[model samples]
Target: MVDHRQRRDELIDVVWRLIVEDGLAGITIRRVAERSGWSSGAVRHYLPTREAILDAAAQRVAELIEERIKAVDASAPPLDALVAVLAAVLPTDEQIQRASLVWLAFVGQAASDAGLADAQGILYRDLNQLLVELLTMLAAMGFQVDGGPASAAVELQAMLDGLTVHVLLGRVDADAAQEVLRAAVNRLLTRPPEADG
Candidate 1:
């Protein structure tokens, strides 16, 4: 007999494939059941409502991203570790590009759905916290974070977000994106505040 948890995972996998292949509008209980070779009722047994399925999918995506970041070597320098985290978030290749597409789709959907928006808020807050921690570490490493690290971290996070969107839209290649990010990091690390005359 198949494990229930396994079945649920299969459903989530099917949902992700459907989202990647057919876009967000393609995820229905009937479609998922057909794709997963399960009955409609069986799929519903795992995810009773469309919203529930979407919520589960969003959470699964977040978990996968977190897992990828967790696998990076943290013993590296803080800037290097932060770059690893940023690279993990970028669409550097096919696998990551697909994941980025799925994430973007969910983000668009979340704009209109209150429940999804709330779920997205949680993910965003977690990512922001991670960025803040990295920036704090960089400050400890002698990087000048003028006016405190939090504001600088927020600015860096915005830059990263803009870079990811550019990568996803094919406006920037991975190498160019990396160069741009490195330049931004260097400037942030080296630029000094204007001194009074």
Candidate 2:
């Protein structure tokens, strides 16, 4: 009896390795089977199509990042918590760099693939909600924010997304990206909220 969940995770690991070696363009049913040492039929038994495989990979990426974010100390100081949460999303290590590559590829592919787009949407939405919660915590602790928590979260989310790309592009190394994120969160928390127009 196949431990279907375990087998699927094993195949996803192969997909991540392929993604690190080559971009998403490198993935195919045959390549996955060869990489996993499974017959193509067996690989198909789990992920039957290219779209199915990519969708699953995207989901795994989301799950991986969410797990990291969830592991941060929620009881820490609000400012520290904010930085930790945002930093968790950045690809600061080799493993996460691979996931980031896969994530970016699916982001582009998601434009034409409705299923992929939905997965991507859920990822963005969940991350955004987490940010909102952390930002709200800061506000509750009497930190001065430039806007409401929701608006501030949007800005932080965009900044984190851009930083992820820069790190992946080699334009910004991981250390510098982390420094920039920490500084940005500090500024956001200290900056005064905007008055109503």
Most accurate candidate by lDDT: 2
TM-score of 2: 0.84
Candidates' C-alpha lDDT = 0.76, 0.84
What ranges in model 2 sit over 4 Å off? Answer: 191-197
Q: lDDT tens digits, residues 1-197, model 2?
A: 86999999999999988876787778899999999999999999999998788878888988989889889997776677778888888888887888888888778778887877886786788889888887786677667777888998999999999999999999998789888888888777773354120
Instruction: Report the Cα lDDT for residue 128, model 1.
Output: 81
Angstrom error at residue 157, model 1? 2.6
Q: Given candidate 1, what's the lDDT at residue 143?
A: 69
The Cα error of candidate 1 at residue 192, in Å, is: 12
Q: Which residue pairs come into collision in candidate 1? A: none
| Model 1 lDDT tens row, 1-197 | 87998879889988888988887777889898899998999999999988778878877767777877898888875566767786676777776676677777777888887887876665677778887887787776666765566776677667777887899888998888877776666666643344110
